[model samples]
Target: MDSADANIATELETRLSIIDTIERDDPSRRELSGADLSLFIGVSVVIVLFGILVLAL
Candidate 1:
């Protein structure tokens, strides 16, 4: 694979690992309440949709 392809793969792996860590219920990390979690879900969806819009443009 080319250098650009390798770089993109590495960045995606890093993001997935970070998400996995955040999703865990560890006390040391963020422990979102139900309301906060709902807000987060809404925000994440918004960001994803925005990204798709940018890509399409």
Candidate 2:
């Protein structure tokens, strides 16, 4: 194959390898308990309120 064709093949192989690595590292599923959900929402609300207060200043 030509130099350009070889470069393209190499690029494709690099990209596919990166994708495989990411898929392997990523979580398959997520599970949260009631307290975890509540805390997340509570923190989110507090952040939003703080942002609004800062903007009002």
Candidate 3:
């Protein structure tokens, strides 16, 4: 269907834009900081805990 095709195209465009944004490192954009690191570590810990709980169950 035409609508489905359009939806696929839009999703592809969005993914491409995200990839481009990540690949292009502009100094004007905010750089990663300590808070980002802390958040990443916290999320990692949560994921590990959830995995352990699932295995225990």
> What TM-score do all the candidates reach, one by one?
0.42, 0.45, 0.46
Residue-pair clash count for candidate 2? 0
Q: Return the top candidate by lDDT.
A: 1
Local accuracy of candidate 1 as per-residue lDDT tens digits, 1-57: 999999999999988897778746656566668998899999999999999999999
Taking all chains together, the TM-score of candidate 1 against the true structure is 0.42
Highest-scoring model, TM-score:
3
Writing each residue's lDDT as its tens digit, candidate 2 over 1-57 gives: 999999999999997887677655556534576998999999999999999999999
User: TM-score order of candidates, best first?
Assistant: 3, 2, 1
Collision count for each candidate, in order:
0, 0, 0
Candidate 1: list runs displaced more than 4 Å. Answer: 1-31
Each prediction's whole-model lDDT (CA): 0.87, 0.86, 0.87
Please give, for residues 1-57, the per-residue lDDT of candidate 3 as tens digits: 599999999999997897678745655555778999899999999999999999999
The TM-score measured for candidate 2 stands at: 0.45
